[model samples]
Target: MRRRQFLAGGTTLLATAVAGCGHPSVVLDMDEATAADIANQVSISPEPGSAEYTVVSAAIENASSTRRGRSELFDRTDTVRIGDSFYEVSETPLESSEVTVYEVRLDFDPADSTAEIGEIAYEELPAADRQRLDPIISDDNPPSGDGYDVGIGYGTTQEVGDGSVFVPEQQYDIIVHNGDRYRVGVSTRTTTETEYRYEATAVTSGVDSFADRVRDQYLFTLTGLSEAEREVVEEAIDGGYFQDDEAFRSVTNRIREHEGLDVTDSYGTWLLEYEQVEYLTYVEW
Candidate 1:
């Protein structure tokens, strides 16, 4: 994400020609050979005011100020050469919020890929709280029962008379089921002096499947890979592996059976890691 420092030299003639022309010149300190190489690559016409010339010229001008490296210009444009590299820009955006913002990431590292949900592990509630919640336990009825609710909640504090009244916030109930954990919660609020309101019942967390895990772990790797290699992983994701348990199991089995595959390539190494991941599941209690 480091900003590349602009180099100073070589385009003195270009700079001189565009000086005092109002807007910032498209010209940078590029040498004649480099400039000529870029011009040829873009196939800019000799006619200065032609459509092709204007578009290429503008793209170069934009790139010189905004993108100065291969990574910076990766998804931006292929016509404008920033440095020595001409990138194969992907039409599909990388599966990351970090990559969306232009000012943040200039380079991507596969090892830095992270899950959106991050780490989920069980945490013990206080003994007293556990004791109180034990009474609500009904193994026959899941947390999705008619009266119970699940999911995140939002509320605000408001002034009542001379004092501020704090509304009941959302609460989470962790349920361990089928070797996985889930978070269920409901929003609570005071309606009046004695009345209360609760809404938004849904399972909010711990729902990732095998394909989801792979997507999170290898997003950057997939982005850097060739179309063929990337397609394998993409198919597993977009093919409903996260929603269908049967499909997820099939993928898991495939990864497990392919344990001996070569790890010489990025995709191969990613598959190896995918095979080793421990998938877990959780549901509302």
Candidate 2:
């Protein structure tokens, strides 16, 4: 979580944008008090201006090293400026065999707000690739025949917080598997238990809805599973639900929308354990 190098400091907007490489970045106007507090916190620094900024439909968590591994900081809704035209300053999340983390939407103060760039217009890409990115930003939810019914499950099995280096934060992952189609990785957040029952109805509902789309529609999928794994997967699929499509789509789209190169020139490691990986679908209220 503490891995990213907060922009060392800001410069001219042009230089800053170029340095950002088109990824969304925070331009800090934080005074000493705020900067120091944010030193341990992850956040976005904005350029300015956001009179018509829209509140998030969902709660936006700050993407942390554990959540996104610091590499995907760019593609978030860092700052959406709505002055003359709608403009969003977002970074493209890095794609890899590992999880591609979507940067969390940082909260904006009145002074910190910016016009949120709307969805990446899918029409902007080639016809074929456009097909791939299309579903990611569609205003259409599942009930329009593109979405159906599915199954869901969540329960916190543990929590780890100790002086030990092995300790982890809350431990949980939400899995949404469509009936005989592509399954979506809904979440992998800090949890003590292998499973957690989130009290929120969105989670319970989102899980079931996420399952249906995979079964009913032709969403993007990663193939090449072993025969044994494939056999196990066959049983996990389900139909969809109408009410939770938007939230279900969100969990699925972030990963579905990601595909690119991800590598590290340097490296470091501590004690690492491959725990049994579990997946669940959740909608943060």
Candidate 3:
């Protein structure tokens, strides 16, 4: 039997070997404000190259005909140049429905800032490696099954099955709490048949250290929402999230905006446009 594997744009590693032992061709320049701005915007917990989990958003590409989902490309391997250093990149697709999210993972060894990798094309990799990377660009549609679809923002939904969720790759979301901005990511899934439990915990530094948080995993269940909450979601879907919702009707709306969707169409149309990532790193049990 073929060994089942996660496909592209998921947690799959793109580059493996260090290629040549020679020096790096491109010397990274992380001094620019753009570098810091990008780093800060994505939320890098602790310092980079500390051998700990560091999340970064390298680039954000609006949805396109070829790239159906809003692709967030990350540098998991020591490929992309970041702030005068090269760190491994990890892409984790947090949730998929109307929007698909991929969390970038970076690991830096303080001394390896000058790390070097070959600029080999995707086709140059070994046959096995090439096959592994095939799913990066796949034609899989999002699933519509019997389960509670929890809204996580950006028109994304978490399909809960087997009463558990596992996010191996660190995917962060920007949210507002108590009139303050915060970055959040889930590491575990906790739920029950009726009530959903969420424990707010603050443990990350950077951005706003004082921001409230429910670290690791933010437990929320579909049935847990009060009648009013469910009504709001239903209303948004009925009226078109982008049409009647004041928060999303404006051009400044970041999370709900999508270039692929027609300006005159409704957000609910995403259901037909919704396609699954070529691969799934997390399985819904």
Best by lDDT: 1
Residue 150 error, candidate 3, Å: 34
Stretch of 10 with least lDDT, candidate 1:
99-108
Alpha carbon RMSD to native, model 2: 28.7
* Model 3 per-residue lDDT at 269: 9
Q: Residues 188-238, candidate 2, lDDT per residue (tens digit)?
A: 344221111111012112323333322233223324445543332332222
Give each model's whole-structure lDDT. Answer: 0.27, 0.24, 0.25
Instruction: Score candidate 3 by lDDT.
Output: 0.25
Residue 159 lDDT in candidate 3 = 28
Clashes per candidate, residues 3 or more apart or on different chains: 6, 50, 18
lDDT against true structure, model 2: 0.24
Candidate 1: pairs in clash: 143-285, 150-201, 150-202, 151-185, 180-281, 180-282
Candidate 2's displacement at residue 84, Å, is: 16
Weakest lDDT window of 10 consecutive positions for candidate 3: 276-285
Of 1 and 2, the candidate ranking higher by TM-score: 1
lDDT of 3 by residue, 1-285 (tens): 111111121212111111122322211011111223322322333355432222232121221111112444333322333343333343434434332332211221122222132123334434533333244312233222333212232112332212111123332232222232223234333222111111112223332221112111221212333454445334432321212333322312321232311122211101011021111111100
